[model samples]
Target chain A: MTDLPRPSAPPVSAPTPGGSNLDVLKHQFQQIWQVLAALALIYMVFFVLSEPFRSFDTLLSIFGQAAILAILACGTTVVLISGGLDLSVGSIFAVVGVIVGIVLAEYRLPVPVAVLIGLAAGALMGALNGTIQVLTKVPAFIVTLGGLTAYKGIAEILASGRDLSRFPENFQVLGSGYLVPMGIMFGVALLTGLFLTKTRLGNHAFAIGGNEEVARLSGVNVRKSRIYYYMIGGVLAATAAILEVSKLNFAMPARGQSYELFAIAAVVIGGTSLFGGRGGVGKTLIGMLIMQTIIVGLSYLGVGTSVQRIAIGIIIILAVYWDVWRRPAR
Target chain B: MTQADTATPLLRARGITKHYGAVVALDAVDLDLHAGEVLGVVGDNGAGKSTLIKALTGAISKTAGTVEMDGKDIQITTPTEAKAAGIETVYQDLALVNELSITKNMYLGREIVRDTLFGHLFGTLDFAKMDTEIRALFQKLDIRITDIYREAEAFSGGQRQAVALAKTVMFGKRIAILDEPTAALGVRESKMAMDLVRSLKDHGLSVIMITHNMQHVMNYCDRVMVLRLGRLAAVRDVADVDGDTLVGLITGAAEDKVA
Candidate 1:
């Protein structure tokens, strides 16, 4: 007994429960400074290299171009944070776009009704993915991979070898000006951020991602919450599809190909864990901007698409490597 | 300690049986807990100690059983139902989410949301209120954790144990169940855990603790229950049992004298 060490108090220098607001702000800045630094550095490099990249319009256009991907990434961020994946979001985007096109062009329905139908279809597809995964006890990676293929087929069948176009002028307004889409992107980001930080479902998402067994023991409704996360993912994908179709005035069955992987890459680049349990919508937003900046900046510098793709691939690997490197040893 | 026998047990379980396929994990075990008494449950590996606790806590379904609080039968089919009945369990794994802050882990399933419309609509957690309450709880219990906002992963083993025990104290209104609370702790931390158990008893909560350590049973528990091969082998007042005798009972070397 005498040889046993005594219990000691935590160090006095440790932060207290009543830490001041300044300390909190400082801690937040510490958490995100790396991403902010990277964004600034990339913007500076582009601004220095290309004359066209210096214009305010280039910045606005970057935001506009980022809108669709940003919207898709928001859903992926939530799903990834919950320790799940949805490879079918790209397909969901195409399916929803085709559905909206048919409703407006062929059926001549109101824009709001078409939009509602598209959103509902997307949510239903997402729910189906979650239900199958949960019920069959299949891994989400496999379940959504199957969804990716199946939903694409469904979209093609719905489109019937014809492009749906010629929407009412009001519908086109959603994607016409840079301000509208940009505003929509920011609005989606803000809402998603609030959902992650403020809601019970958001907190539960982190808990479930951190440890599914622990969350279950803590009385979290794991199955229902998981289904809800996938639903949100689906709805966001649908929203992006609707915006894209409005901008293009045509819905192609091939639309949104590979967007799922792109959105996931952007989320991973933003520092969201690919393994789940730690991330935010704000981080995803920054990640989306980083990718958009590189794509637009490279094109302005007369770089080819193949080069841009290679650069993005390298950045994704580096971002993931950084995540792994910074993780404290188990 | 003598009063424990005569005062109707705070919690009682009868004929608790659990079967998984062809294996009988728990063979109609019985348990009794008195108010303000620490009851230690001991058994060898695969001896149904955890099975019994899970059955009681509704972590696992029982093949057959009845659990009563103050002699009134209560329905417990899920962990939430068990919690609603004022029964809290600190599982062997501690069940703490490492990435979440102490405040979040403390109120993981049952958070205190704000009174505003946003809270009502979105179920917005009131972090300020939760922080204040948990801070006050730690102070009242004399637990030494200062940063309640730090993630659970950042804490030492003993500190995490403290957080888990504090959670039990906060919500275990009538009964607190702990499974191997000190298995991962050092000698000093083991003593600290026992001290916290004493505090829980002092706070007038009945406790059902499972441990492999004979010293803890002798030092802290008023009475001990031993399970052997999924069956309740013996129950003895700690004063009447020595460490060797208890080990014999656990290993099937000694006769079941008290039964």
Candidate 2:
């Protein structure tokens, strides 16, 4: 609970100098460590809920699946940080799957060629969303809602209402391959986290979502930041789709149905405020793992599909409810 | 005690006029602010004070006017352009992001980068360095606070004012316009803000303060400029006027200065 906040503040210690200050810093680190350690302890207690499915392989599988959601959530974390919502991301993921499938299976394109097309299409879609939102000065929610429908429709049209199957051997290997895609997901998450905490654009993203008008007055390029952030989201969502087809060896326009909810739920559960500003990719990774663990563990326990679905809804409601602590004093 | 009175004023707006749709917001306004001086702007609500400040900050474009920096006339159509030209404005809201730490809020849009254009990651905000620099800046101005890393929401109003001013100076601003720094603040906080204003003059930064408070004009500012409706009322040295005479000027009945 306490570890939810990163070091947004300077290290606080009495100015006691050269060697002793190291001791003071050590002491501060101890406090943060304790808080994080406490959160880990709480997570273990929940394993009682997932006890029946507790196995080495089960845990590894949970982590692998969590890795994908974590990467997607990291991207959403950036958008939320910049004060945007990409509802069309779900549809974009489905469209990417269909595109990658068709190119490799029907057109017999190279894997890299299909990937480039998939990534380009995603970024282009996200740019359109950002452009419309900025030009109309409307809320991103409205623009992306329209995008949600249009993008999904585009995915369906590409599939012609049929499932895509029989990808080339290399394509199948990339999707369900044990190490590569899983490794890619983790690497993306780590890179995204580093980018959020380190880069200039990351700083601008936080500032834009924090108080956009103030940021504009302070010389932060709001529009440029917006476009970059949405583009990042586009790439992440589309990558998730490519990985999905790579694993499953098939794709349909419905491949990404409801995935937007999972990504959003992960970010929201991770403590990223939908109000924009604050929160980072690291916390979102934790949120994603937590969600994946809950869902995957429940499935391993042979929980009914309907029950699992209801629990996901309940879990999201519960997560948002905890934000009562974050509200400003009345 | 200071060289600002005769120093080439950092910015001067002459014969400025702006209108929105049909209503004139600023009318033929002329004002100048110099290093080592606090030029206090006073008027009632809707008296063109805010509109003039927006124009000065380049939040609004001048329909017909010229803004000068070091005697060179120029055009600024945006706040970013104003900043590039070394003019900064701290609005009444203070504009600090409440959720971010003080240094994070201070460098909100102007982070200090290291070897790469990409600044530090989370751990790289250079807590020790930013803390040291901010501490020295505050100490030089004789302001003290417990936490420089706490959220701005936790700071006292006076401390936040100091932070806002520090942010402006840190951005290398040559001219700063403060919109009612003391308006909703308590007496002690108000005094703190005024002391910071005094320190800006001491550091050779020009400041233009907008306020309706007469005591601020008498105690701190070198020159008092009055705005009546959408026009220039007058600009005078504090030595040449009293509170009653200044109020009369705002009301438009005072004909001439009684020597």
* Candidate 2: pairs in clash: A175-A246, A175-A247, A176-A246, A176-A247, A197-B121, A198-B120, A198-B121
**Residue by residue across B1-259, what tens digits does model 1's lDDT show?**
3445676788989999999999999999988898778899999999999899989988888999998889899988889998999888988874588778888999999999889987888899899999888989988877777667667776666677878898999888889999988876877777777788888887778899999999999999999999999999998888888988998899887865442
lDDT of 2 by residue, B4-26 (tens): 44666668788888899899888
lDDT of 2 at B28: 92
Docking class of 1: acceptable
In model 1, the runs with Cα more than 4 Å from the true position are A1-18, A161-163, B1-7, B255-259
The positional error of residue A241 in candidate 2, measured at the CA in angstroms, is: 1.0
Q: What range of 10 consecutive residues in model 1 chain A has the weakest lDDT sum? A: A1-10
Give the number of the best model, judged by TM-score.
1
TM-score of chain B of 2: 0.87
> Which run of 10 residues does model 2 chain A get worst, by summed lDDT?
A1-10
Q: Pick the candidate with the highest DockQ.
A: 1
| C-alpha DockQ of every model | 0.41, 0.28
Candidate-wise lDDT, in order: 0.88, 0.75
For every model shown, the clashing-pair count is: 0, 7
